[model samples]
Target: MSVNSFLGVFAKSPIKPMIQHMDEVNRCAEALKQFFKAVYANDWDAAETARASVVEYEQKADELKRKIRLNLPGGLFMPVERTDLLELVSQQDRIANKAKDISGLMTGRQLQIPEPLTEAFDAYLIRCLDATEKAKETIGEFDDLLETGFKGRERDLVNNFIAELDAIEADTDVLQVQLRQDLRKIETELNPVDVMFLYQIIDWVGDLADLSERVGARFELMLARV
Candidate 1:
């Protein structure tokens, strides 16, 4: 196909909406950083404001997902399978949904990271957010991938991006294990209920990284199929 024709096909494809949805998901994930800052400061009001941003972005992602599902062209030719694109969006949406769930649960409980674990928790959370950011970078490569017909340097670049995402996720896993061990040491000193919820929050935060990895895996599957 001619370059213009290729570009035209991409314009009508779900790629733009997919990128837009990831943008929203990234925003939702980012808002958590601010939310945690407020939580660390014991500032519920600021934390609530940040949580509201997470909710807003998650809602925006949801709307984009709905439109993408409803408007994905059935008869139009696409570089990837329609089902693959749909599955990708579904995976992307889960990251945002998990972000919403994390923030809502923490805010509702006014949960606080124990002072002893605060520093380690911050590191773990940042690494998890790094995974989401890396996922966004990987997804953003789709336009270039399509332009290059999913070959040559562009495909290699995407492979490198996915590799970086995988590394970030691995780092989060290690951090999660250490944080859990640290939390375990102090659990006896804390209220039993709060300790349980703290562990839950740690798991939920880890889920962010896990979900981001799933997004990378989905993209890898798309590349393989091509």
Candidate 2:
């Protein structure tokens, strides 16, 4: 069941379809960026528009995942284990799900961004997006890993990519903490319920980065078997 060459079956490679799914995930991340920026500007309408994009991308990603899973070849041999690959896809899918959740919660509640928390929230969102971007890049290396049979210089390169993702996640963690502190500054000024939900949104943002980190960690585990 071993593949002769990944390029030979590029059309059928689960990796290829998975990459497309990751692309949609990245799009969700971008939409989040715009959504938050609009919120910062106090442009609720624009933020709602941006959130629509997130919802759309997330839905598309889910659709793609279903298609890939349905068409996934049984008993096919690859550079990485099939089960692990499926797990990786699930992990990546969680990121987009988190993005959608964050957007849905914010837009549904029409949560107003506090002026004092704007700066920190913006930075925090950017850091979370960075982690997701790095995760996408790490996933992009799958073709190379398959071509090289997950060995030699190819393995080293992916290792470095995973390490960079880890760094991004760590930086995002710091941003999350700072964002919470900033939220504290304006807690009294905001309605009690608003403050509670804002804190929840910040927590969800952190969850997004944490999921991205998990994607990279799972990738490392897959590489270990190689």
Candidate 3:
């Protein structure tokens, strides 16, 4: 392929790469949901399958990230600052990282969900996914923002999405706290090591929402500079 063709394979405007990264993050969210369901059911086979998909998506996100960095043009002709684009990608990538981290911890040590924490755990994970989905939707508006030059209805629309994303993230934070407190209530009854691993998993799952919120924040910053 010619150089243009090579770049064309993955290329869109720089913002497109950021959208692609967020897409991977969204996929990770789905994979995580499946993984959690399988875990809750004690179906090792399905859990393994879902875990593999999460890891695969995370790897794909990393590859796209590297390709984005390598192919990003270094010229004033770009739509946004290259540094800002890089940082945005990095922030979005963290969502996938946390998804993979949670899955890894689940499958690595065979961490079983505590009986009392099961309901809380499921709710917390779903809320985290909600936060990420909101972030993905926010990134999906980039093309519209570009068309409107980040002004008028598009600006208001994206700002609204960001606000909702923040609200969802705030809810996730409360869930995390409640989940932790629930975990501690049962901590004395479980294996000490298992308790440790469960705590680690819960913390990583919360990080997913945290990263998603940061992704939304980064996009807002991009809007400011646009």
Residue-wise C-alpha lDDT for candidate 1, range 1-226, written one tens digit per residue: 3435534545675587788789889999999999999999999999999999999999988887877787677865766988899899999999999999998988898888999999999999999999999999999989889889999999999999999999999999999999999999989999999999999999999999999999999999988998
Q: Backbone clashes per model, in order?
A: 0, 0, 0
What lDDT does model 3 reach?
0.85
Q: Which residue ranges in model 1 land beyond 4 Å of their true spot?
A: 1-11
Report lDDT (CA) for all predictions: 0.90, 0.83, 0.85
Query: lDDT tens digits, residues 53-169, model 3?
Result: 999999988887887788877783645788988888889888888888888888887788977778888989899899899999999998788888878999899999999989998
- If both were scored by TM-score, which would come out higher, candidate 2 or candidate 3? 3
Work out how many backbone clashes candidate 3 has: 0
1 or 2, which is superior by TM-score?
1
Give the per-residue lDDT digits (tens) of candidate 2, residues 1-226: 1234433444567688778788888898778988988877878899889999999999988887776676667677776677887888899899999999888888888887788777778888888888899889888888878888888998898889889888888888888888888788778888999999998998899888899889999999988886
Instruction: Arrange candidates by TM-score, descending.
Output: 1, 3, 2
Cα RMSD to the true fold for all candidates: 4.3, 4.0, 2.0
The estimated TM-scores of all candidates read 0.94, 0.92, 0.94
Model 2: residues >4 Å from true position, as ranges?
Answer: 1-11
Query: Which residue segments of model 3 deviate by more than 4 Å?
Result: 1-6, 9-12, 76-79
